[model samples]
Target: MSSRDDTDDLRRPFRHTGSWYKMGSRQSSVMDSSVQSLREGSVSVLFCVLIVALGPIQFGFTFSIFGSLSNVGAMVGALTSGQLSEFMGRKGSLMIAAIPNILGWLAISFANDSSFLFMGRLLEGFGVGIISYVVPVYIAEIAPQNMRGGLGSVNQLSITIGIMLVYLLGLFVNWETLAVLGALPCIILIPGLFFIPESPRWLAKMGMTEEFETSLQVLRGFDMDIVVEANEIKRSVASTSKRVTVRLADLKRKRYWFPLMVGIGLLMLQQLSGINGVLFYSSIIFQSAGISSSNVATFGLGAIQVIATGIATWLVDRSGRRLLLIISSSSMTVSLILVAVAFYLKGNVPEDSHLYSDLGIISVVGLVTMVIGFSLGLGPIPWVIMSEILPINIKGLAGSVATLANWLCSFLITMTANLLLTWSSGGTFTVYAVVSAFTVAFAAIWVPETKGRTLEEIQSSFR
Candidate 1:
């Protein structure tokens, strides 16, 4: 080789700028970029995850609110979250959501009358309703495909953690103190948004090309080569941007209609399985089952849920989404059946009899198993799938529709749970059991495997 050719080969391995040594070869650069991108993506996703995750915590915390009233407020928010997200972008919408949450918690903390409590709950519900749709959508938009499912699972994990925190705190502190504590997450989240980049996909979709590349770079790492990924996002955005506006009529196409149906179906089954009802009146269920310490049992239930959801975060990407849902739904079906059987047996046995005591123990076991089954799969996976399956063109409107369906079902279940229990505990559980069984069939038949797929790839699968 010539002298200059030899020097060029050496330079190809390493480039020196001042005191810094940078990789010169494409292979080395790509490797380094991937590592740095992973790190940057982790940090960026962590903040986004923390901020949006708070919405679920808020959702769980506000479970103390009375009746279907909070659901009414949440329904209103769900319907409007799409417009808010479209107008202000994802980060801005979340910031706006945080304001109401903070204000709502503050109102609850100082409340002497029912009006303040009710109003506070309404505000809190509205905020979480927006969060329920936006956070998952934002996370899906920003996350690298490999990390998306795991990060998306964090939303549900945060919710389980929030529920446990409130339940634990309720054991020690006054309601006012708990309300103050509830506001703290949003207080932290509002300023944290300034540190994180806006969703690059959102920026690209809005035609802010320079900002889109910049945000994507920030997310992928300053030193990383984001050109390939950037182009992919731009292409995805460009394909949808031609339409400019998404209307309900566009949903008539099979590609749009199928995914929308999947999103709405999973959410509908999620509520119809009676999770909220079980959670809302867990104490009553335990008491009726003859548990001496219903509070302790409730606390245990929260602990189990948190632990199971945490395990799910680790498993989601590795195991994929559909398998977990099937397992979760099937197990929940069995557990609910066990609960129903226990309830039926308890009703038949005399209170003073040994059989009654045995039935009580069986009921507790069944309830705990039901919770474990739920946390294992159904609780987190549907949201992950919903966020994954929707095309960017219709994400805002379809997300709103799916979320509205979720809250609507939640309202119906919550409203009827107590009455159903009054009529027959065995019957209520049997109904939930049947619904859980149907979930298994639904997941097996329709839900797609989304692991290791890009957003564009996922959308393409439907077509």
Candidate 2:
């Protein structure tokens, strides 16, 4: 093939229609089946994502909370979520998580002192921590293999939406009202969980044979034949059932360790890239860059993230995960370098100089580019890859560890960002730019192409 043809092949839309079974004669075109599959699965996946996304909103909104305490709370929640998922199942764990979310919001909404605010944020962090792990796992288990990447991308998309909402709302409302508004998703999710079926794979894993079949029917559509898919789940579950409780020592095996490394590494890279630092401190970054309307610029940053993440949902399954990550990290590296250069020049140029204005514009443009680059790839892909790669037996434990690493890195970046900024504005972003450069190399070398593969197929590749 010509070079152009190679490029076109890489960009070509994924052909898998997600039709798990042979459609009857009554079924229409391939488009119809694909649409039907998406329609049936979208409702459950989107609803679950919507509920879990509240956690990300709370995460973003932590900029308004006390220090790094919220992250500390998330660390605690991350450690606990795995056990809750195993004991209560995905749906029940999410339901239980909602109570803390609601109460946490209430505490923040009516805080009489710093103590209430701190406690509230900690509770909120804990709720989000559980949500971070469960939402993707649940979605991956229920979605059809063909559409899983697309559906899994929704978790990140919802998170961007949540963050954007909080950013916009914070402009007008007081902290208390914003806290009250934050409670709304948990309230909706608590009741909405009842309507959705438990994950079929989870049910099967637990030996609930009849419930597994029923849950699979609900997700796949009642009229559809589920025999093949049902058997696949049973076989996958049976294979792992012998080791229902995955111990830390099991991670010594390559099959378990490889995906775990991928998961933890991707998340660590995602956080170390300074996405959260840029997000939480965009207004300050803009102001320091000499933008008069820092709030508007921050809003624009949030908007870009939401739009780019939205685009990722459509592209993830189509363009494939690894390519996007490469593109994203490369773009981010360039953008961060641009931002660092702009800041470097800002300090050197006199305020009265004509070049100062040019530097400010460069800084703003570079910041916007960085946000777009992140939203397109780093923002969503790590979570998608994380959800895709881990085996069912080790998923709960490994996922928690990966998530904890993500939050811990986030805390370190957020806590030190201002100090670093104060030390040297250009140098701060230079460090992040170097990390972004490394991320490109990491994606090229370690990240696998997970598009058009079943969860089992993806996991088996690690062996």
**What is the overall TM-score of model 2 with all chains considered together?**
0.90
Candidate 1 per-residue C-alpha lDDT over 104-219 given as tens digits, one digit per residue, 9 for 90 to 100: 88988998899998988888878888988888888888888988998998988988888888778888988899889999988888888888789988997787766877787677
Point out where model 1 deviates above 4 Å.
1-34, 63-67, 244-247
- Model 2 Cα shift for residue 190 (angstroms): 0.5
Query: lDDT at 211 for candidate 1?
Result: 81
Clashes of each: 0, 0
* Model 2, span 1-463: residue lDDT tens: 2345324433433223235345777456654665676576567556655555544555455553363777778888888887789889999999888888889889989999889988998898888889888888888888877777777877887777777887889889987898898888788787878777888888877877668777876676544556667766666666676554767787898888888888999999999999877887888899888889888778878888889988988898899999999999999999999999999988888998889988988988988999899988898889889988988887778888999998899789878888898899899999999999999999999889999987877866776
lDDT of each: 0.84, 0.81
Cα-lDDT of candidate 1: 0.84
Worst 10 residues of 2 by lDDT: 9-18
TM-scores for all candidates?
0.92, 0.90
